[model samples]
Target: MDAKQYANLIDKELQEMPLYVFYYTQQPNLSVTTIYQYLTEYRRFFNWLRETPKDIENPNAGSISDAKSNKEIKLETLKHLQASQVQMFLKELSIKQNKQSTRDSKKTINRTINALRSLFHYLTVTADLNDGEPYFYRNVMLKIPLIKGVKESISYRNAKFSPMLYTGEKKRKWIDFIENEYEHTISTRRRSSFLFNKERDLAIISLLLGSGIRVSELTRLNLKDVNLRDRSIIVLRKGDKKDAPLIADWAMPYLENYLKIRKQRYQPDKSEQALFLTKYAGKAKRIATNTVECFVSKYSTAFPDGNRTTPHKLRHSLGTELYDKSKDVMVVATQLGHTGISATDQYIQQTEVEKQRIQLDKTK
Candidate 1:
């Protein structure tokens, strides 16, 4: 087959492969997001495959920039791909530049490899990988190990490289900003259901900024998940059933107020099992992940420069604050629902006062 036909065939197959593996395979509880990300990785690989220098009878291969004689990509080529090619692909992700000389970040490169690993595992075991013909990529992909502890420095986006983790004055300023500026602005705004939304937004923002709740965890919460009496929430972190994360006492008032308004706003019969609902629709429906992101985008203006005010940022802010107050790794771990200390360690940051003292002692 010529390059153009092969390219068209490959694109069509790659698109169908993930769904076939996801649904037809016997795996359970894999979230939609994981499948989406894996599909993205497949697209990235195939895009580069078009430019690979092998003499595949593909006509469009020349259309890809800098096509060379050393590489080739095709459905038939996948099974033949040895470990060396896989390693080269993974390495190229971090170092390879586009026409603009831009490269993927260390974090993204790592994730892309993970996605490849998953897809290749599927290709190895499945019949035709949902693309009408059987592909035996298992030998190649399953053998490809994760890249780790490499001596080379990882590339990252320098433009927005500052830690999103809030600390000290930045942390305190945000707390006050949300409490005073955000809460007050919403409370006083001349809009319908201002009180209802303010109460709800405060509860959400406070929960994220106070309890270190992941935005996914926050969205997944149900009425049964919350314990108003003990101010605790039973959150399913990373899809595992775990002990409930406790809510801050101060955030309770907002939760109490929001629940009261939510009940009044939505009819009991039509309301879904979602803890957070949208009022924009006549029928109160669950707030989607996109809604949660848009909500953060809407209120991000309240934060000062250097403080990126996304939901994850708020969680980091709260985690750092909790660590500062408790000085306990377990405390941070339990609240954030992290299974390990290494994961929780990233959340804990030195307060400005502590940093200042350390610097003073350094001179002394």
Candidate 2:
């Protein structure tokens, strides 16, 4: 979703303080998606506090009022939050079931911690309240630590996804399988829709593998962002950085094919600036992130030696391939629009782990 969509969602959720609005909108660095996520995390923590009121105390030795709604929980509640209560919230998050009914991962828990930390940091240091003073002098979040085992989680993900990634020969064959072979594999009922969307799907998957752009970047892409002559496309990268990443020569043909027939096939309104469009309920709208994920999964599951995968794995395929060829972490980082080499460093570690795994398999 775009900024407006995310803002609308934020409006529907609890906006307990003007500080919440300022935190999300006034900050130039936070992406719309990040704002939405942080708001939800704030709500989660607030709800947890309401349910576990014993965790809360009035700083002035006064009784804490029962918060009938999330909005009813005033700023003073956050000011007096203790370290132990925050720790308990993190523990609950670890075992919390999402809409998928699966327990939250450590990453999710850490993100929640990070979100709360941002909020507290702003209240204590950033916000200018009455008399030019911040909300509170004590930041409880400073005492909380993020969950560890990040490297282990990265290794686990690398091991599981490395084999499924499309790189080298697999990259070319995956696209080939989609064009010539995919239709034959699906049922007659599904084939019609598949054929109708073949070009757009191919372009989407090809772009993902060809350039290491995030799924969010691709979904939020606009028609004017593509510079075909320069062999690059401009994107609003994470942290809202405007970047133009080069696309692979191999993926150009698929993109070109899609461009030639996009308007005719999708019949999008002239005012529609979205680079990719899907026809739904007789209206052409920008292709959504979930829609891209679904088709990517469908195609990968049908491909021989392919597992059900996400657009991110396709990004990994590109990143790993770039690192292998250039043997330079900086180049991969630039292409992937990573602010630091740490994330790109995982590509190197993942490849090393993959190699070690193969050697072990050979020994076995």
Candidate 3:
């Protein structure tokens, strides 16, 4: 089939297939965005196949060709992908001479590999009996092994050896550090608008720190999700599941105050049911995730020690704090919407043993 026809067929198949069935049969908790991304990636692979030389005997292999010739190629094209080709791709990615950090490179490689794997897997399941199914086609691409140097750096970068939980004396110091720098400034039109919406910003920060919510989840929150009387918010956690829980005591007052100020600042349009809105935009629009990150970074800059501050840092801080307080692995996992306890345990295991030893010396 031609490229356009091929795409139309794929789209038709996707539309006919129930999304819920895909979730249940394949990735049960997959988000709609994730599924859509996989579909796009798979489409790109087929497009690439349509252009590339199909036969091993063809010396001019790897070159793009006309679509009409693609159908003449044998179905063995799907089964004959070499492990060496994948390795070459990885090598090219690693040495591409970009300014991206090691973490960014890792992310790019991981995403590309996942896209490739999804295409191959889809072919294995969907292709007809006449298609030549090779042995290697069944083996999913192995996860890239972390080099020792990369692994060690990532371990340290994630604060796998932090000295203290973010609570008690540490929490007090951090809070004092933040509050002291909280100058109520209205320097520019933008600043004035942000200042006018300060209460909402504060509430958002508090909730982030308290709940360990992802930025996307924070932006998607609506008024109906919050229960002021119960001091809880109904959040759509990962996998698009509704889960309600109590707001941390520290965050509740801030939210209440923000709601009061929000009522006075702008009239909510009929379509605007979101709890948080952009300060400069009309109340009909919700605040963007990047706006929330920018605000956090702005405040974080006020404190010299807050160099690593971002929306995600608040999540890490909460997880670290919870682990320190309760020492309950499952509790922390549930709070952070983790599917399992291994994620929470990593925080616990990463606690600096040397720091604990030093604290023991203080008692003497």
Candidate 4:
């Protein structure tokens, strides 16, 4: 087959492949969404190769004159791809011009690695064998090692703000005040909308603190996902096909109140199924994730002493609270919809203050 046809064929096979096959075959526990994403990335790579000139020395020679030509490029491009080239591509990505933050850069690296690994694995297993032997696809795999870097010099005077010395009671008090007093307070400037808006904010914060759901998951919530009678929400956990339990008994009352106001304000049009809505133009009809984030940020700023909180910080607080209260790794894992106990362990692991408290107890 020609290059374009081969690319199309691969895309088709990827799209048609059963996710359960991966579990029974080599890579068990690999999510279908992950596989799809890898395939998409590989397709883009092929498209780039097809468009790029084979010989950069002579740009005008041996190049497809018509931009509209949809014919497949040479198959040699795929065969010629080497480990060095792939490594160079990764390096280029690391230094690529973009607005990505440190966290986003890490995520991009991870995604790129996954995509490259998936492609190479597919080629090794499914494609023709090289040298009549199994070609292990290890070259594309990330070779990350935890290397210790130079430690920063610290003076005794500079070493301050130790977690063991810092009492979190004051911080907790501030958080409590924000939740209890500042969160629900409303102004009379807009009488008709005041109660509705306040109820919405309360429900939003309550869900964040109570269920510890990610902002993305919270935004995707629909009326069907909610179980008012059971006081549970069906949250779409990462890598899961179906929504799982994100129950919060405390959040039910506020949710109910919000729902009542929501129903009254925006009587369900055919397109409106989301739990939240906004009054802004273009978004007047549909609720979005950013809207919820902005709402959370606005109220978070009301706290005295400039305590900067985000929707995600509320999730962290919930996890911290659960860890402190139960001290059970499995319980926290289940509550947070985490696939394993290790994630929960990270949340509950004793801080310096907790360690100091233990030491004080031993002295006592």
Top-TM-score structure, candidate number: 2
Per-residue lDDT tens digits for candidate 1, residues 1-364, read 2223334554554444534443423345454456456666766676665555443367554533232321234445566666776676777877878556898776777788777766565566645534765465446766765656435311222113225655557655655665566655654454445444666777787788667888878887888889999889988777666668888886788788778878777653454677887765577766666666666656666465444457887776777678778888899888888878886644443333457568999996
Sliding window of 10 residues with minimal summed lDDT for model 1 = 153-162
What lDDT tens digits, residue by residue, belong to model 2 across residues 1-364? Answer: 6455777887776356344445435667777677788888877677676677562454444323358767677777778877887887788777778788988898888898899888888788877754687777889999998888546567777777787788988888888999999899889999999999999999999999999898999998998999899889999886668999999998998899999999999899999989998898999988888889988998888899677889988899898889988879999999999888998876887667757878899986
lDDT of 3 by residue, 1-364 (tens): 2223444655554653323223222544555455555655444444555654544468476543334443233335445555655555466666656445443376666666776665455455533333454223354354434323355543465554343234445554555554444554325666656556677778887888777787768888898898888777888887777777556888788788888877567666777777887644443467777788887777666554545467777777788778777878888888888888877765575444446679999998
Candidates 2 and 3, the one with greater lDDT: 2
For model 4, state the Cα shift of residue 257 in Å.
1.7
Q: Model 4 segments beyond 4 Å from truth?
A: 1-76, 99-107, 120-196, 241-246, 279-286, 350-352, 357-364
How accurate locally, in lDDT, is each candidate?
Answer: 0.64, 0.82, 0.61, 0.57
Considering TM-score, where higher is better, how would the candidates rank from best to worst? Answer: 2, 3, 1, 4
Question: Per-residue lDDT tens digits of candidate 4, residues 163-255?
Answer: 211114544444365446663565655444544466777777778777888776787788888887777788767765455666567567778
lDDT of 2: 0.82
Arrange candidates by lDDT, descending: 2, 1, 3, 4
- Tell me the spans in candidate 3 whose CA falls farther than 4 Å from its real position: 1-29, 32-79, 98-104, 126-149, 153-186, 279-283, 350-355, 359-364
Best by lDDT: 2
TM-score of each: 0.70, 0.88, 0.71, 0.62
Cα error, residue 134 of model 2, in Å, equals 1.7
